[model samples]
Target: MSDTAIEHYWDTLVTPYELWAEPTSARLASAALDLIAPSTGSSVLDVAAGTGALALAAAERGLHVRAIDSSSRMVDRLTERLGSLAGCSAEVMDATKLLYDDDEFDAAFSVLGVMYFGPATMTALTEMVRVVRPGGVIGVVHWARPVGGGPMFLPLARAVERLDDPEVGTLEIPVTTAYLEGPEVEEALRGAGCTDVQSETAVVDSPTPAPETFLAELDPFFGMFPQYRAAVARHPDRFRALVAEEVRLVERGENGHPVAHANIAYGRVSH
Candidate 1:
């Protein structure tokens, strides 16, 4: 699927869920931007630049940035944000099939957008590499495996698995992320014809609401998409209660303060 398609899907689920997930989302975005290290005056392409978080950071670093998101709503919002600044622009575009010509950007970056490609990850990476100047840098950040700390919805994974749906637990290539190591990221870069690939990990942590509060905020997400909406509709009260219970369990063990964390993998491609 195209980046815009994904963004369209996310626009429904994100806002309500974001109300609860904002802390972690901000932390992850900041961490990814730190790894990207955009230089002042650089021409940067921010793939899937939802809501302009990373793009805004790049502009703050004095970079000239053109950001694109598949979701029109996201791009529209980003445009407004960038219109408020002189050095940034936002557009609706796909990561897998970039509208820009080859060697169009000095650097390119994605935060958490790379991993959501389902089966089209390599195609998306190839496009990212193609748009950058030879020797220009490409940086990607994906959430590390194992649903790193917090009250993750292990039950959701289990539910998906039980359904035997191909989309669950696999990338577009059907590669299991459970084996995702730093080297695996390098391999993906190499597979995309990227030379001099290198990768490392960083920690992302954010403060979160109490279990009860968070789950209430999350209720809308369970209905954002058809599949999830069907599942939630099947037993809305039960699913809601389960999430609240898990949050309570997490909070009780830690005095109601839960800090969510994830391992972020950053991979760079040589120009």
Candidate 2:
């Protein structure tokens, strides 16, 4: 999808994205911050800020934060959420091309955001590094695998394949998972001139009240993918079949709520 399409999709889904994804996003943000551990009053940049999950977490810790996202609606939501916060702001900006000066922030981070850059992942990471001070830390959290597992979207991808839409092959979901595999993220940070790079994986489990609720939460994400949308438009019954398969795959947690597992890879930027 083009940048404009991505932005439009995000803007259209902001409400559902926040309702469904914020809790997990918040958990990942907390994990990334724990790894970076910038001092209070530190200047921080949140790339692809997305509803201000990381920005809000940093500001609560007394950090001065500048958050940016490509979707103006997402940025608006973030700004509203940051209302009255003393030292935080959100703006609409492309992650691949940061507008800040070199070494301007004490630290920078993204929570499942930069991975969507696909071929431009390195550019985004480099821009992130360029804006941080010499010894400042850079952190990122991305899925070890696609959320809800590969099969969740495989049917849709296959359908798109049958239609011969080359764009579907480049869908953000698959592209992100493919590019973020293993040491790829760490290597990218290192390649971006960050030193002392380190990474670890953490599993974030979000439990919904029931399987139905779980599927509802996942709906926004499924809708966000252009391939899924197109496939659903063309083959509603097939799409429903895939969704039913997804429902059957969901396992109940110890507490009876449906538990979704997200393997988050956390990387620390070098000095």
Candidate 3:
């Protein structure tokens, strides 16, 4: 997707996007922070930050944060979030071409955003390498597996596949998941000049009252896929019914919680 297109899609849905997503993003941010282990007071940059999830996490640990996103609305939401945290800031900027000086930050990261950068993915990775000082940490957390955010969307994907509703034209699953796998991301990390590249998978819990409500909980994000938005707008009841029916496809854990996983890839700029 073009940067402008992505910006518009996210800008229009910022409110609901954060409503459910911010909490999960924040959980993943904590995992990223635990892996990178930067010292307190170090300068950290969050690339393509959506609503300052990682920024807020870093700030809570006494780090200085700068977050950027292509969408001004996202930056607006992010800035408002960082207002209480002194020495933190947000801006609207392109991730592939950072505006700061070389070796400017002690660490940098992007959580599930850069993989969607498409053709510019490598440029964004290299730019992260450039802005972080030699020996600084760089991390990116992405949805693990070929289906992206994993089975968290399985109900929707299954529903779309089963529906085959003519009113919705064609429903294509999200295409950015391939870039999110551990090896693919680790390759990108090393290709960008990062050393000691490592990868880890962590389970991110998505709690809901019942399995069927998964789509209801994350409808805004799926709304970005116009087919989903149109399908639901036109056939709210039937569409949700199909989503609920497909809930059987998801692999639930012992206590019946939605178990999604994220891949965190991290490394140091060669000393």
Candidate 4:
């Protein structure tokens, strides 16, 4: 996909994404940071750092954080949120085409980003590995396919596919679905020159007051593609019903909050 399209898509969803996706991404970023373990004086890079969630977390941990995203709006938000953070900076840049020198960072990571690059996923990973020092860590978090079933977004995706609009019908499936399995993530990390790779599913309990609220929060994904938006606009009631049914299928927690699962895939760069 063109950078313009990707930027437009994300720019359109930035508000809702910040309100909804940031919480889950923050949790995942924390997990990745724990695995990375960058100390004071460490230089870290946050690729595709939408709204600076991971970058802020790293800076809070005392790492010098440099964050980048393709969407200028996202970068602006990140910059705004990063105001006066002495060691943090945000820039508009593409993950696949990083502007830093080799071994520029002590560690690099992305949370629920980079995985959507389709054929460019490896290119982005390669750039991440290239920029970090040989012994640094590379961490990623992506959506895991439900065991014995499709992803949580499959119902919505199927609805989009049924629209038969050529633009939407041919939209590439998310790269995470093909690589969230431990073995797949491990192989990709290894392929990017990471050694001692490790990956696991991290089940995050996202508790919303009700399913409707949960569905609303997920607008970032469901309303991502233009065709999907058109479809939703064409059949708002049907879309709501479908989402309600899907949420109903989810197991509720003791506090009545629905749980969401994510996979954290990480590895150390080879020395």
Candidate 5:
């Protein structure tokens, strides 16, 4: 996806979840914190800090956190929500090209933010590694697997499959659980000079505002497929009916909750 397309998709589909799913977000963050081994007064950097979820949690835990995201709207929301937190601040910055000195932070982390990259995933990972001090932790969390784990990605996978694009073999985005389960994540960290790498599973609930609201938010990503856009635009009622059915299927297993399974990776850059 183009940068503009990706940005719009995030602004629409994810921004609201940040505001409404506080409890669920907190759970994943607590899991990440458990793996990171943060210390009191540690200087932390949260790259791709959407709505400041992990960053705020880190601050509340007594870590000094400086957070940044590629989306201005997300950064703005984070600032508004976290302004009063003495040790936390949010800024608009690209994860792939961080504007910071090397080894500037004691630890760095990203929560469910790695998959948005369009071929820039490595650059972002390297930048995260570069900013953290040697021996300091670099932690990451991404949605877990086979397209059924994350509700948000399910429709996306279905729509893409409908398009029948051969190149769409798998969702290569960092957010997918399959990406984290493989050896690639550890290898990437090792290539970035991180050692003692480890990753584990965590469940994160992503509650939608309403069915219509959820579908509307997802429209941007569906718009990427011409057939999907035409289907919804031409048969509005049918499109909504389809979404409703999918929602029912999701609610059954989740107890009406949209808790997504994700993987958390943690390791330290070598000193």
Candidate 6:
């Protein structure tokens, strides 16, 4: 299922969402620009641009950017973040069916977005291909796996398992997210007619002011993602306790900050 269709899931997230999410997205954006290498003044497109992370990053490099999201509220939040930035704009639009002309951009990127597209990733990548000029580059970032890099929820999941709580046994996050891999993303980019495909891993440093404060800030995300909803619904008290333990471990290991490794898959199909 394409979870991006859930507008309220994204709409309800704005400043709070960006507070923690942007750090990861920003790291992904840096890796993306390193991959795409768009020069200053090059036309760029950010698909599924949540709070304009990649868009804002590109703008900092002097690239003309147009950020699009399916959620109106996301676009509004991004627009506010982009105040007074010339040659940059944010708008609500479907990523699978981009409302733009062919060969319109020099490069395109999506950071920590488009992975939720699930079956629609191909459509989104195809649209991105159609809109970029021949030889133009496009990339999409997705949560890879637990081996080389783990998602933020990994520690919490372990904490839940260690507690032997029958109520929270086997938390079910979305199937699409649990097993997402770089090879899967590479296949999608190839299926979209992109050549010279490449996939690599990069560390995402997500900052935290303090363990408890970070937990307080992350409360909103628990309601946004399904696995969190499942855990909270099953036994809110147990899950909260589990997260508390995870926070302690995080504090000890990484100064209370969390980190994730994301897959960056990028390629270009000559139009």
Clashing pairs for model 4 are none
For model 3, residues 1-271, the per-residue Cα lDDT tens digits are 5657868988876876576567677888999899778999999999989888899899999999999998899999889888878789999998988999999999999987887677788899999999999989999988875554545566676677666777776666666645667888899889899999999997886533245676666776786677788778887888888777666544444223466678899999974
Ranking by lDDT: 3, 6, 4, 2, 5, 1
TM-score of each: 0.76, 0.79, 0.88, 0.81, 0.81, 0.86
lDDT of 1 by residue, 122-223 (tens): 888889888988877777665555452233443343343344443323111223343257677667777776776667666544444555565455555433
lDDT of 4 by residue, 173-246 (tens): 54454676767877877888899888877767543324566456666666555666776677677656755655
lDDT digits (tens) for residues 58-154 of candidate 6: 9999999999998899899889988888889999998998999999999889877776666677788899999999988988887775322235555
Of candidate 6, the 10-residue stretch with the lowest lDDT total is: 146-155
lDDT of 6: 0.76
What local lDDT score does residue 146 receive in model 1, on the 0 to 100 scale?
Answer: 45
Better of 1 and 4 by lDDT: 4
Of models 1 and 3, which has the larger TM-score? 3
lDDT of each: 0.63, 0.71, 0.80, 0.74, 0.70, 0.76
Error of 4 at 151 (Å): 7.5
**Prediction 5 TM-score vs. true:** 0.81
Model 3 TM-score is: 0.88
Clashing pairs in 3: none
Off-target runs (Cα >4 Å) in candidate 4 are 146-177, 207-221, 225-235, 238-242, 245-257
Please tell me which predicted candidate would have the highest lDDT against the true structure: 3
Q: List the residue pairs that clash in candidate 6.
A: none
Q: Write the per-residue lDDT of candidate 5 for residues 180-264, one digit (tens) a residue.
A: 5635666666766788998788876766545556567655445555555555655567656656655666667642346767778
Which candidate has the highest TM-score of all? 3
How far out, in Å, is residue 192 in model 1? Answer: 1.7
- Candidate 1, 35: how far from true, in Å? 3.1
Badly placed stretches (over 4 Å) of model 1 are 1-7, 17-22, 146-179, 224-239, 252-271
